[model samples]
Target chain A: MNLSRTKIGAILAAPTVVYMVIFFVVPSLILFSYSFWSSESYRVVPDFVFTNYLDSLHSAVFWKVTINAVRIGLTTAAISLVLAVPVGYYLVYVSRSQTMLYLILITWFSSYLVRIYAWRTLLGTNGVLNAVLLQLGIVDHPVDAFLFSSFAVTITLVHIYLPFCILLVTSSLSEIKPDLIDAARDLGTSSLGAFFRVIAPNAANGLAGAFMLTFILVAGDYVTPQMLGGSSGQTTGLLIADQFRKTGNWPLGAAQAFVMFVISIALYFILVSLGRATGLIVKRRTINPKGI
Target chain B: MLLRILVWAVLAFLISPLIVIVLFSFHSSPALSFPFAGFSLRWYAELFNNAQLGSAVMKSLTVAFLTSVVTLLIGTTASLAWLRLGKVGRGFIEAVSVTPIALPGLFVGVSLLVLFAQAGLQLSTLTIVISHVVIALPILIVAMKARLALFDPSLEEASRDLGASQFQTFRRVTLPLIAPTLISSAILAFAVSFDEFVVTSFVAGTETTLPMYIWSMMRRTVTPLINAISTLALLFSILILLGAWLISHVRRRSAVAARIES
Candidate 1:
C-alpha cells in the first residue's frame, strides 16, 4: 500500500500536533489574551485593557527587577561561555576520547535544586568558605557578602549551566573540520589568527545561539535567584512568580512574562546584529551540496 | 598543557558542589562549616524515618514514570513523521516542538496556569503530569530525530517489496533497529521529568513533588537532613544515567559480535 508522503506525514504527526495544539499552543494564546484582561480581588475578568501592561511599565519595582535579571543573566552567560569554550575546544579538537565528554554530561544530570542548595551551604555565613577563610587568617570575620547576594546567584548559575554551554559549543565546533584550520595555517596565518579568521566566523551562529540560550534560561530562572538572592538579589522571575503564588494576580503575571519574553527576543536580534557589525560573523554564500 | 589544566579546573568546579553535599551529609554536627566534627549516619537515619519525604519521593516517581511513558508514545510517532514529512511540514513540526525548550520554563508554567484557570481545571498530580509531558516531549523528539536521521530508508522499502504491510514493516524492521535509541531516549525523558522543578512549581497547586518538599525544608531551616535528601536525589539521578550508558554499551557489544559472526 503506497501512501502519499503528505498523507503519511499527517498520519504519523497527528498525535503530537494535536497534543501540542491543545496543551501548548492554545494555552499560550489564552495566556496572551489574559495579559490584556484585568484581575479584580484575585479574580481575572475577561476584558481588553492595557492596565496590566501599562501598570507594569510604569512600576518602579518592575524596572528594578528586570534590570537585575538582565545583569545576572548577562554575567552568568558570559562566564559560562568563556569557561565552556576551552573545554569544548579540547573535547572536539584536541582529544579523541569520549570519556571526558561523558563525565562532563554526568555533572549536568546531578539534579538542579540540589546544586542550588549545595551552593547555599557552601556560601552561607557559617559555610565552608567562611570556615576556610577564618582558618587561613585571611579575615578576622566571615564575609557576609558570600551568600544572599547577586554574586552568589551569578556564580551558582555559572556552575549549574557551564556543562550545558560546553555541550552546545562542542557540537557547533565539531562542524568546523580541522582541515579548515590547517588550510588557514598553510596560508601564512598563525594558530590564533586561524582560529579568529577561520573558526570564529564559521562557528559564530552556533556560539551566539549558545550564548543567547544560556542568557534566556538564566534570566528566566526563578528558583536559583530566590534561593540565594537576598532582598537585593530579587529578579523579574521571582517578582512574576510572586504575582501568581503570593499576590494572586494571574493577568498581571502573564503581562510581565510577555514583557520579559519580548525583551529576550529583542536582545537576541541586537546581539546578532552586533556580531555581524563587528565582522565576527561572516555570511557565506556557498550552497550545501546535500541540500538539507 | 594550559588548555588541559583549564578544562580540568572547570570540571572540578562543576563537580565540587555535589561533593560538598555528599560530605556534609555525613557530618556529626548540624553545622555546614568545615573542620569536620567526625562522621555520623544520623542524617541518613532521619531520611529513612521521615514519612513526608518518603511520600514525596513516591509522588515524584509516579509523575516521572507517567511523563516518560506519554512522552515516548508521542515523541516516537512525531519523530517518525519528521523523517517522512516534506520540507515545510518537517520545519513547522520541528519549530513547534523545540519552542518549549528555547523559552523559559516559567513562561510555559504561567501560560499553563492561565490555561487551566480559564478551563476551570483543578491543579493536582494530573496537572503536574501534563506539564511534565510538555517539558519532556521536546527532549525526546530531538534525541529520537537525531537517531532516525541516520536510519536507512531502503531497508523499509525492501520489507515493503517483500509483501510486508507498512505497519508490519515498521514493527518487524524499523522498530528493532531503533529500539536501542528508544530505550535511551525514554531514560533521558525520565531523567528530565524527575529533575524538573520550575514548571512543576507553578502547575502543582497542592501536590508536592520531591523538589517542592526540599524547597519547603530549605525555607524552614538549615539541617544535615537537607544534605542527606539531596545526596539521595543526586545518587538516584547518577544511577539512572549510568543505566542508560550501560544499556547502550551492551547493545554495541552485541551488535559487534553479531557482525563478526555473520
Candidate 2:
C-alpha cells in the first residue's frame, strides 16, 4: 500500500525521461556527431572529419548570411525588447488587469506563418501600406523595397516576437515587487531613475533571457526570411535548412546548425557580461559575500 | 498616461495583422490592399472546395490529436513525478523537459531530421507526431507542474488510507481534482501541435499539415484563398486558446467560491 518517494518518482518519471532521452538527448548527440561526418552526393558517409566545420567556417556565403542573420536578429530583439519593456512595465506595475496580458498571450499563439503572410500583404508593392501611402499621396509610386528587404524581415520579426518578449519581460518584472519601486521613489529618485536603478538591475537576468531567447529564435528563423527577406535577407537558418532540404548534405547542414547554435550561446554570455559591465546585472557573489 | 498609451499601441500593433487578415479574407477583390471592394464568402467557398487543403486539414487534426494524447500522458506522469522527487531528480527532469523549447525550432527540426535519417525511419505524419510530442510535452509539463504544486498531498493519502489502491487513489482523488488543468493543458498541447511548422516541415517529408499547406500555397501564388485558409487556421487556434483560458478562469473562480463557502 505504501511506496517510497524514490520508487514512486522512478515509476512516474520513467516514461517521460525515457522519451526525452531517446527523442531529444540522443538526437542532439547524433546531430552533433553528424557535424563531423561527410556527405557525398546526398549520402552521409560516417567518417569522422572536420571538413564540414572547416568548410562552413571558410565559406564566404556562410559568413555573409551568418552576419546578416545576426544583424536581423539583434535589430529585431532590441526593438522588441525596447517596445516590450513599456508594455510589460504597464502590465506588471501600472495595471492590475489580466485582460491585457491575456491579449498579448493570444497574439503570441496566433499562427506564425499567418503573421508572415499578413506582413507580406501589408508590405508588398501593391499591398496595404503602399495603398495608404498612394492614397495619401505620400509617395509617387509603390515602393518595391518594402517587401523583399532586410527591413521587411526585421519589421515582421519584431511584430511576430514582440508579444512573446513582452510576456517574458512581464513575468520577469512580476518577481520584483512594486513596493521596491515605491521605496525608491520615496527616497527622492525619479520614476525613470527608479526604473533604471531599482528595476533594471533586479530584472536584468530575466530581461537578458527575454532578449537572448528572442535573438536565438529570430536568428534561427528561416521561414520569414525565405518568404519576405528576398536574396539580400538570406540568413544562416535558411542556408542551413537548404543543406538538408535542398542540398542533400546532412553533415554540412548539421555543421552550419552547430555554428549557429554556438553563436547564439556565445551571444548570450556576451550580453550577460555586457549587462554586468554596465552594472545592470549585479553579481550574486558580490551581493552575498560570505556565500550566504 | 504615456505608459498606458504605449501599452495600447503595442496591443493594437499585435492585433492589427490578424485583424487585417480576417478582414481581407472577406474581400471580394483579389487585391491585398486597403480598399475593401466588397464583402464575399467566395474565398471561404474556395477553401471548402480545395481537396488538397481539406486533406492537409484532416492530417493536421489527426496529428494534433495524437500529439495531445501522447503529451498528456507523458506530461501528467512527469508532473506527478516532479512533485514527488527530491531536488536533484526534479532538476534533472525539469532541465531535460524544458530544453527543447528553450532552443530554437530549427535546431530541434534539424536534429530530429538527422535522428530519423540516421535511424532509417521514413519521414511521415508519424514522424511529425513524434516531433510535436517533443515540443508540446514541455509546455504541458510546465503548466501541469504549476497546477500540481497547488495540489494538497494529504487528500491522496486520505484516499489511500480508505483502502483505495494507488490507481484508485489517482482515479478517484487526484484525477478529478486536476481534471480542469488536465483538460486545459491537453487543449493547449493540441493548439501548439496544430500551429507547429518549422519542426513539422523537416520531418513531414512529402506529407503536408495545414501550415505546410499554407506555406506551399504562399509560394505557388498570391491569392485571397490563402487569406481564407489562413483566417480559418487562425480562428481555429484562437478558439482553442480561448477555450483553454476560459476553462482555467472558470475553475479559478469556482475554487475561490468554494474557499469562501468553506
> Which of the numbered candidates is closest to the native, going by highest lDDT?
2
Model 2 residue pairs with clashes: none
Q: What are the candidates' individual DockQ scores?
A: 0.78, 0.82
Chain B TM-score by candidate, in order shown: 0.96, 0.94
How many Å off is the CA of B24 in candidate 1? 0.7
lDDT of 1 by residue, B1-262 (tens): 8889999999999988889999999999998988899999999998899999999999999999999889889877886787678788877887777789888889899889888877899999999999998888888777777778878888888998999988898899777777777777788888888888889998999999998999899888887899999888888887888887787678767866886999
Cα lDDT of all candidates, in order? 0.87, 0.89
Give TM-score, chain B, model 2: 0.94
